[model samples]
Target chain A: MAAKYELKLGAATREAFGKALVELGKENENVVVCDADLSKSTFTHLFGKEFPERFFSCGIAEANMVSIGAGLASSGKIAFVASFSAFVLNKGFEQLRVNVAYSGIPLKVVGTHSGISIGEDGPSQMSVEDLSLACSLAGFTVISPADEPSMFALVKQAAYHPGPVFIRAGRVKVPVIYGPDQKFVIGKGIQLTEGTDITLISTGLMVAECLRAAEMLEAEGLSVRVIDLHTVKPLDRELIGKAAAETGCIVVAEEHLVDSGLGVRVAQVVAETSPCVMEFHGVNDTYAESGLPEEVLVKYKMTGADVAVTARRAYGRKK
Target chain B: MTRTSDLSELQSIARTVRRDIIEMIGTAKSGHPGGSLSAVEILVTLYFDVMKHDPANPTWALRDRFILSKGHAAPVLYSVLAETGYTPKDQLNTLRRIGSIYQGHPDRRFIPALEASTGSLGVGLSLGLGMAEAARLDKSPSRTYVVLGDGEIQEGQIWEAAMYGGFHKVDNIVAILDNNRLQLDGWVKDIMGIEPLAEKWTAFGWHVIEVDGHDIVALQAAFAEAEATKGKPSILIAHTVKGKGVSFMENNPKYHGVAPTKEEVELALKEIG
Candidate 1:
């Protein structure tokens, strides 16, 4: 199982989103894209180039953009607002919470350059806590899909998902792991591997890492099940429960911090309803320093190999 | 004091709303009465005479949008909505209570007529602008009206929204500022003044009109003119007292967020009468 097939799907989250939006605009005339400036950085320039009339650039005004989205939403149009994750989620958070989520508008906030992966840009641009902020909203769906195929699939789904959604995307270029034909379903976990020893639950950028960890672990005689949960909010509870029942132990990993990440959702599901031994692999309460994605990930101990070590620990705690 | 039944009808309805706000706040044991009372005339005009909203069909897609940006004054909006049959009149008693749709803020999830959920200031204008832009795009005839507190405009986000609206030529949007000039802590002049307001809006490229807020005819004229104008968004800078009609409350900054005592309620209703 030596890194079998080198998972060839390759595209940055913003690039994948840009490509998918171009595809969506070709089909749906009502799908409008709004940006608070940062159009080039957010990759929304793709949509702007294709549908200039439909793409709105508000220019560094995130709060206004969010509210404008709510207004457009009331009129039966699917509005997608794009910006850097930090400003869009943090600066304009109250507007998103009230105008979009509370009003149940069909607004999709596309957060580009999520996580500390926007290396050398400094902490000002990093949006490590956006997942938690999005998840806190009652009806807001938080989607952090991994690779080009799932990113495209989720973007398509969000266009139809009735209510507000925040899609977190990283700037880093990683290997494409899924085939172009692979379908992504909201609130559904794709089982990358099946095992009885321990379940490895991961999402977003961390999904690829878990696959690598699973491959490395198989070499050490550990057959770990890996579940890629593309959507974090609605959370595939049925699959998580089934996996917890079958494996008796689980290791939850995310590129976000330990709290309110996908790990927290998984832990809540397992702890409250189904009892299982669980270990969380995430950035423990701390600011990430400037570094390459690989170097930063390795520093935070979130690689597939690091995840494999935690999976073993989880398996040992199982009955 | 002479008036037609139509004017008396609106005046009586406004009194009913004022009474309802006091009673509901008393029942909830907490709610803003000053701004609520101050907005009664505007809300009355919009609900009864102006906006084309059907209470029975709150989800009307092409229905004109209304956002109570100064959501603290939700008592007036909710009271009007309830009396108009948007919800059971009895539900007014549940304001701010647990599990009640009538929150301290107007939650759009609970109230359908509410176009946007707003408590945070300065956001309603942007929402209106967006809806107006969308309408322009869809060729929808529906218009969006957003009510802003004069105090709320101090938020940088509101200026950002104002600038964006002016830059985009979002014509179908109307921003109404309730320039009662009293905020939570004190008189807005003592807090952070926003004077020369009409000039400010005019500079921002809006078709600015300053109106006597309590004058029904002036309000009607301002709104009518806003609808008729084109190519630029409009702003109705309504110069109002901190509390209108209620003698004790008017011009008193202390009433900015105070719930009325039972005695005060009796006095307020009598004053309106």
Candidate 2:
């Protein structure tokens, strides 16, 4: 497999979110941030440092932070609240439902340290169901950016967006998949490579692994297409249908539970628009143990080789 | 300060609001009446006298904001809005019906004039604090008031906002507890006690003011003191009967959610008159 684009190690998506928040704060005076005592880890402290008055530290109260964000949004401010995905999405699910989603306020919520990638924290801190929880909410724009540049661009886009948004960020550094010059749009998937044999669709940190899997499949004389489906709530049905029709085989991957993550949504699109042989690669209905991120991902069958195996099975089943 | 003449006018408005609450719930056939009746004077005082708001310009940025955290009491809020000209008086009958702007719960989607769409308990205080912080950031004098229920404070999120408000010295925000002393299942104390309530607020760094929930004059003065106080938030522990105006419904948990019958509505309206 020959590498088509230069792959550089970038800071974690959480760090990119922090830098982007600082940039948003500098540009928009109405930008305000709320953090639930994990400011340092979530990197919201960076924005807090630049805009002290606009930043609200709501202690360890994620539920209160969510409603407070809704309040600020209702009062004509671009409000954002960040915490660990498990804590923010689970602890604040009711507030998110009633205050932000039901009230129709444009409150931006960022959940850092998502999925099993926040290694060594154990399953209690891991958020394998955050995407499911977020996507279920009506009027919420859910996003899971693959890398630093995409997260940076998508977060800025989320701020200008006029509705509630939920962005899933990660604790581990990932390979840069896009350049600074690349333009991003909400509810649109960015295709990283062109192919015809099969398509690799993924979001969040799994996008990089999908790219690696594509390379492995290409080396075996199979043409593979790779797409980054960032916005999960308003699922890019058109692009997904196109891939399913063109490639005849689709493998959906993510660092979440296969039962309810991006895979289920992609399958729904395939069933409705273009029926195709499909495979899902993710945490197969179980939680991972305390280990290094790479070890945990490999153990849970969420690595590139793992995806390649799943892709091969789907490809073999294709007519 | 409220003059005697103004006090009587406010009392008159409160009586009308109480009648409207009973009639609206009675027509709906299924709505909370006890809590709604308990909050009439509080909403009347804010909408009719205390808050600075224009009915025509409901979205006015500078107008004071009021959030009904104990949102099952929407009948009282809707009646108050109609009395203040925010909504048409005739529309009050459509409450809890399909395709009606007046939803069973307070939903701002149906009526944009509402500060927040609240029905679930324990989140409005935090929302009010957010509005207060926004006001501070904009350097606007617009204040935010949140009305909570005695039983609703049992939610942990209320204490979360309480701690934030007091520690941050959110002076522009005031929370009023409708101490109706009753909830759906039974008495709040029998279900889950929140006693030493004033000391609880004081420990949270709030300026606690106890008042008669039905007294328009005392409520006006308490709101003034809350406004004049600096470097802290305020909470008014307003003592009120669960169903104040109707003899049959007063202090009765059965009326907490069950609406009055048509005949009962007639008797209740006469009692309010």
Candidate 3:
């Protein structure tokens, strides 16, 4: 498969979210934002600066911010609550479960600085279980956009979609995967490369890595299918099943714990729909040390090369 | 000020609400009777006279919203809702039954009339504050009322909301603390003391108004004062008995979650009358 889109350096997804939020604020009068003292870090400060009246700063309380978002959403407002993934999803898990998810309020929960990619701050700040936590809550749409462009599109879509949406955004900049014209649905996967030997399924920053791995495997004359699974919950089970059936081998790479990350969900779909040899590549049961994002990814074996190695192993085990 | 006849009428409604609470909990065989009994007058006052809401148009944009933060007291809210014509009075018997609109806690999913699905403590004030902020944003003449249990306030999230409401000077929401002074285990003070509570809320920048929880007139006055107050939220520290009407259940921790027996229910109904 030939690559049609050119990969370029882009800002972090969180940065794109900030820009998109400002755009959303201008577009809709009811669109409001809430932040838990991490507005600067999450880039929601951009929206705050543009629409101070619409933006609510809930100090350092994530739990309060979540309930406030629910309250605002209940009263005909498109509320987006922003905080670090670890802080928002973890600190406000109960509130998310009760006020938002259980009550079925259309609150957009944006968790920035997700996964080991948020380096130097250490594991305390890194959220390895946010996807699992968000997915566990029923009636929550869990989205993990691959890059800035996708983040912008999905943020707009999420606001329009009337339900509780948890968007996992990253702090580090990465290569742009989608163009400005690329359209994204809430529960669909974008197949970047077409092949049948094996499939590299990934989300978030790992999608770029999977694309790189596909390129590496193509050089070795191995046909590889690369899928960018941006939405983790309400997962594109159709695409995953098709890939599993056609390729007969699957490798899921994410910047989260392998135990309960996208791999487990993908494995479930594959097991139920189409059985396949599978390999999960991510931060396995252990936390990565404080270092640069690239250094931590390498140390935790979450780079393109690592995914490629996992793909090769899974392909070799293919029947 | 609440007129003399109106106060007596409100008291009569409260007594009937208390009777309904005892009967509903008695029928369900499991519920928080103590807290529900404790919050009757407060909820009855809001739903009947204080709040600007219409039962026919439950989700009216301009209607004042009531969030039962102490969700265990769903019987009281449910009874008051029925009394105010939000739901049918007969549905009270289906309190905790399978597929009932009234769950063990207040779940808005089952009953759309509910402003927020709240069973978990310490989260409703924030939810109400959000609604209040929304009302302010739209310049709607609507207020948000939240009922907080004394034990429920023990949750750190309540203080977080208090800090936000007080710091932001949110004026459109009013929080009424059902200071029944009793929790499931025992007395709130013996379990986890929240003394100097009025000072705590005042320091948090809320217009603190202490009143007797069972006093409908006092609650009405406080809600009126809260509506008039500007630049900050209000908290009415409603000092109330855990179980007001029933003799055996009054201030009894055993009745916090235990439903009344059939005989006890009959006695309670007589006492409430």
Residue clash pairs of candidate 1: A9-A176, A10-A176
What is the C-alpha lDDT profile of model 1 across B1-273, one tens digit per residue? 112226768777888888888888877778887888778878787778777777778877677788888999998999888878887788888999998989998887777667778887778888888888888898878888888998999999889888988988888888888988888988888889898898999898999989988877788788899999998999998888877888898988777777778888777778777
**B4-99 in candidate 3: lDDT tens per residue?**
328778888888888888989999999999999888888888887888877778878899999999999999999988877778888889999999
Q: Put down candidate 2 lDDT per residue, A110-182, tens digits, no spaces.
A: 9999999888888999999999999999999999999999999999999999999999999999989897689
DockQ of each candidate, alpha-carbon based: 0.75, 0.91, 0.92
In terms of docking quality, model 3 is high
True contacts kept of each: 0.91, 0.91, 0.97
Highest-scoring model, lDDT: 2
Encode model 2's per-residue lDDT on B1-273: one tens digit a residue. 222328878888888888889989999999999999888888888887889888889989999999999999999999988877778889999999999989999999998899989999999999999999999999999999999999999999999999999999999999999999999999999999999999999999999999999998899999999999999999999999999999999999999999999899999999999
Q: Per-model TM-score of chain A alone? A: 0.96, 0.98, 0.98
lDDT of 2 at B243: 91
Which one wins by TM-score: 1 or 3? 3
Segments in model 1 whose C-alpha atoms lie over 4 Å from true places: A1-5, A315-319, B1-16, B26-28, B83-85, B88-103
What would the TM-score be for candidate 1 when compared with the true structure? Answer: 0.93
What is the C-alpha lDDT profile of model 3 across A106-224, one tens digit per residue?
A: 89999999999999999999999999999999999999999999999999999999789999999999889887678899999999989989999999999988888888888899998
Q: Please give the RMSD of candidate 3 to the true structure.
A: 1.7
Judged by DockQ relative to the true structure, which candidate is superior, 1 or 3? Answer: 3
Q: Candidate 1's error at A113, in angstroms?
A: 0.9
lDDT for each of the candidates?
Answer: 0.84, 0.93, 0.91
